[model samples]
Target chain A: MAYTQPHPRLSVVSNSSHSSVDHLSPTTTSRFSLPSVPSLHSSITTTKPGPNRPNIYDRPLNKTRSAEVSASAFAFLFSEVVQYTQKRVSGINDLERQLNTLGYRLGTRALELMVWRAEGSSKAPKRELKLLSVLMMVHTQVWKAVFGKGADALERSVENPDEYMIIDNDPLIERHISVPRDMSQLSCSSFTAGIVEAVLDGLSFPARVTSHNTPTVQYPNRTTILIKLEKSVLEREELLK
Target chain B: MAIFSLWVINKAGGLVYQRSFADGLAALTSNEYLVLAGTLHGIHAITSRLSPIGSSSGVQVIEGETFKMNILLTVTGTKFVLITSIKDPTADSVLQKVYDIYADAVMKNPFHTPEMPIRSEGFDSRIGTLIGTGQT
Candidate 1:
């Protein structure tokens, strides 16, 4: 974490005493074998050992699952979520925004895990063009993971072309929400919106997700999240076969 | 069995809400309603304390003119007192429907405080519909 401004190789020679073996590691290749690291370009220039350096991304993500959690436990947890967004917001729109962001972030991690735990392992896509298909897969799979069922509906916006909406009836988290008072504007299911955004970003879809209230009998809190794709993504999609 | 109105008592025995669906039951002043809630809360608490297992099957069957205000309660010990003057015997189901509406509109509402006064629009409106439901 200590990111000191690294002095140039020529400048370090001015400190003549401790500079004897200043740049020896790269200059003198001993028995240490280092693989070709693209981001490790500056390693050859460091005169002093960058303290406490270890590869951070080398560790696995899923450390462990809590032994006690079950289906009922999730329902209660979802109840708490319904309560959490109750206060500390302006109106229904803000509440929905918050919920959308939560859902989107959860979507990100869920997408990665879903792909990893699939019947066939997935290779993470590197380019934007190959990512829309991945994005669709993420919407379908990750929605099923968190919401307990696949999304009720999905459609691209006709006029805008870049906008899309993923519909969910009876989002489990919203089952317990009974928004009160001046906040009777919308359900507090914006947490789901966050999870959706997370999945989109994780799959390199790069879109914004906002939850809209669309209530039906079987699906009271039918959230239709409008996702507006970034221009770069549209261009990439057009370029791809 | 019949009901004419509904009242909810908080855990501490405070009467937070009261609404009459029928004509037999008279309205109480705001302060009187509060006093009533407190008294009922006390009674429910005293009854619960009488139990060895710490559960109160709260006060029911407050008989009135050609009508009755029967009480049901949530598992959390909050009272749901319903008043009805209906001649039909199937009055219990009406109260259950009230609870269902409460659970969906009020309990599911993030803005609703559990065991507090029922102030949700969805809740109040739905209850209004349930009360006048075939009572022509």
Candidate 2:
């Protein structure tokens, strides 16, 4: 309720400042005096004390694109997250599932933020109405925004019409993570798979996404994110076609 | 220019990881390796105390006839010891790189417990490649 309410005091201050500017003559003395009113008003409004800290929504979205966390720092944080998830799980699969759940929450937020960023201040933001277009967007824009590079490949499965894959030669999430001999089946990229699934789900695609370690001799950390669409989605696609 | 071996000791003077690159050095048993780590850790502490200046860092470089040992003690008390050829000038730099790799591969590993023996294949292969490149 507090957040939804517009600041009456702020609007009143701004209105008075605008009216004052109109009354002032276009002289150097007026110009010098003019800044003092707005500056005083701004200083009072901007520097709100204690609990009135600006929320994320209050901040500008178009921040520096080049802003990055050091890879080592991310690795350390991710490692701790994995270890924390591992503590509560019964087995490797359970651990991966928990990690996926953790990523799913992040995915929803990431999708919304990505869409918002793409829309900018445009009155009419374009939406991906088709399946292929949405997948391409994820494979390119979403992947680039999240991992700083586009996925290596996106291909539809030959056997399954509803199945698709997004391949990354070296997924950034698992770059430093090496699965031990006993847990060779465990792919840390399952977290990324969850993110992809959430993105699709957010767009009403209703798909299940999973990550597989499809390593080659050249790229030992190669990962393929497998997406399986629901029957309803496929039927809708056909209807749209 | 040739690196012979590397050893990592945890804060409590336990051998967490050990690897030998060269072939000429006589092989020691696993127990001996642990003992060696503990002995070196003790000597390090003793040497630091022996220093005339107050609160000096312990034995960093131990020079021998055939090989030299360079020790890097991290802020967290983890020790990285590199054994290189007697005349090798890049031992310190190589140790620093090894520390970087250890921080990345071992410390960042989700499966790795703090101060535990590191068994990650990524750490092994990277170190192997690093030492291998250094040899050539």
Candidate 3:
């Protein structure tokens, strides 16, 4: 039997006979469906305001907790970054400076993450207050975390009291990068230099850091990251001693 | 197994890089080399279309009486052609290694522009060492 008109409440209750409800006038059904429309719209709008997807800030900061990315992937990405920076800059120095600036941002983030991870560990976190200890932390902890190994050597410059150097026998970033003969002066390790500079800067040890290609007979890709502490920093170090 | 030479053709069928290992090989002028690369690229395309069962990768291994040429076409259309001795069984493996090196050295070098001639000193040295080991 055809029911041309049915109560909205009865139609909702008798969902099994949905085909009969199709015979009802479109205007009547639309009017009845209008009440549920607001609820559906409200639900969608609620989800829109606060998405179920996790934010980056909510993620764990511990390095060990995260999956390690392949070195080749990093190499490919670093290569592209260098190329992108190369196009924007004028001279090799300008390119290095720009790369250094980019690395500085990474260094700040790395420092914060490392500190957080260290605090999360079992051992009581010891604050690095002195210049020597801070340099040691960078040479050991920072290098180990970033490059998977400690720096080869850390030495104070005999000629200059304020100057120090951290030597890396083979810098990871420079492994596949071969600077052309024409631009032999350009060292990609300037990025790492920036990282070291940022770490020092963040720790309130103001210093200028620059990377130089210091190849030897044994190590072809040896890089020396020179750290030149400011006069104020040296004076503070003397007071601490 | 002795590798005679290597040629790199960009996606546009242009000769981008070439290196010769053995001495006493016939030397072609730069212009002649470009023409040779273009001819080989054209031949590969034509042969792929000529396959009986749908399209196939063309002219993979071209064997001469004394030498054999192995062509490796990457997904991006760059071709790495390695010419080795006819008796060499490891030509394909060597070609694979060459491709890996190209991806690392040439592609990774900021100084190297895509589809241009590769003049990377590191690439040259690494390729030399790789092919040199194969020769010995």
Candidate 4:
């Protein structure tokens, strides 16, 4: 503060009109010091800070910022959506199908945004991909968007080359669903159906999306969206690489 | 006013849901309720298209002086039938509210099975209270 103060000849003290820089001609007003300031003053001047911070912000460590959202608001909106789709549908299949279709559309939009976010000013995941590579994209990109975490596992079907399943432990979509007896067979994982569908579709691997419940030790609401890829998709994967 | 019954008929005049909320209608077998739904569905269709020009075919109020019969039809050719002996000015509002509840809580629910009996969690419990209160 003492070294940076302007020459007394250019004294302007207004908050908005400040150009607070001055040099000591006679004396720059004896270095103003508080009773408990001697120790703090030396530390502040000696610290080799990475960069000089602007006056607009507080100390570097205290300047953290992030957007905030209310979880209850999201839950309420989701509840309304679930209620609306319940009106005309007949069976469990239809309910799950609707949720899946909704999830798939959202998945497409999320995938696009995620790619943009990750690839900003940097080389992104290139076009060519093995099945494993695609799974990684879904894990790191799509899963983060949906559940705030990547999927638990992506397993290739042992019995069938055309089949793969992305496992989500405690899927967010199933959180509000308390299916009734009339819909005893209905699983609310269909919302994830749409998301997984979008990922496969984006990867040029056309597939059917289906959600089924798999209760477990850690997460009871586990959902595995089974993606059965078309034979042509495999061929395209080969040709692209 | 006791709610005599509620029926849901598809466009094809098939019974999707039928339940008795009162004791007036002679107790019918499960098969009979289904048949009643089917029969009412057919009658509703005949009445809707029976007109040469067009038909409003909805909320046909049958004033029973003490009680009232209400037959409501959706645009998709589904009918919601409610029979009650309560005469109140707010009866129509109550009925409309029921329809709104069904559309929002039941129709939009991703868990609701299409063309199936309503089994949504909020739909069932909430609609149950609304319908139950209206009956009293």
DockQ, all models: 0.30, 0.65, 0.68, 0.13
Question: Compared with the true structure, what per-residue lDDT tens digits does model 2 show for residues A56-143?
Answer: 5665667745567787788888988998888898998898788888889989988998888779856888999999999999999889
Give model 1's clash tally: 33
- The segments of candidate 1 whose C-alpha lies over 4 angstroms from its true place after superposition are A1-75, A82-101, A120-139, A184-187, A215-220, B22-32, B43-58, B73-75, B86-105, B125-136
Candidate 1 lDDT over residue span A1-241, tens digit each: 1334455443665666356666665555542454455226556646434555434464343332212346545655666675586465666676677666666667777766666555244465333247555556545766666655677777877899888877777676665555544554665556777777786777677887776778778665677777888888888878875
Tell me candidate 4's TM-score on chain B. Answer: 0.75
- lDDT per residue as tens, model 3, A1-241: 2464566558666874675566566756785779787678778877664555545676556645445668888988899899999989999999889888988998998888788888898488878999889999999999987888899999999999999999999998888888887788888999999999999999999888888899998888899999999999988878888
Residue A188 of model 4 has an lDDT of 72
**If scored against the real structure, what TM-score would every candidate get?**
0.65, 0.84, 0.85, 0.46
Supply the TM-score for candidate 4.
0.46
Docking category for candidate 2? Answer: medium
User: What are the runs in model 3 whose C-alpha is more than 4 Å off?
Assistant: A1-53, A63-66, B133-136
Question: Who wins the lDDT comparison?
Answer: 2
* Candidate 4, residue A5: how far the Cα is off, in Å: 22
Return whichever of 2 and 3 wins on DockQ.
3
Q: In CAPRI terms, where does candidate 3 land? A: medium
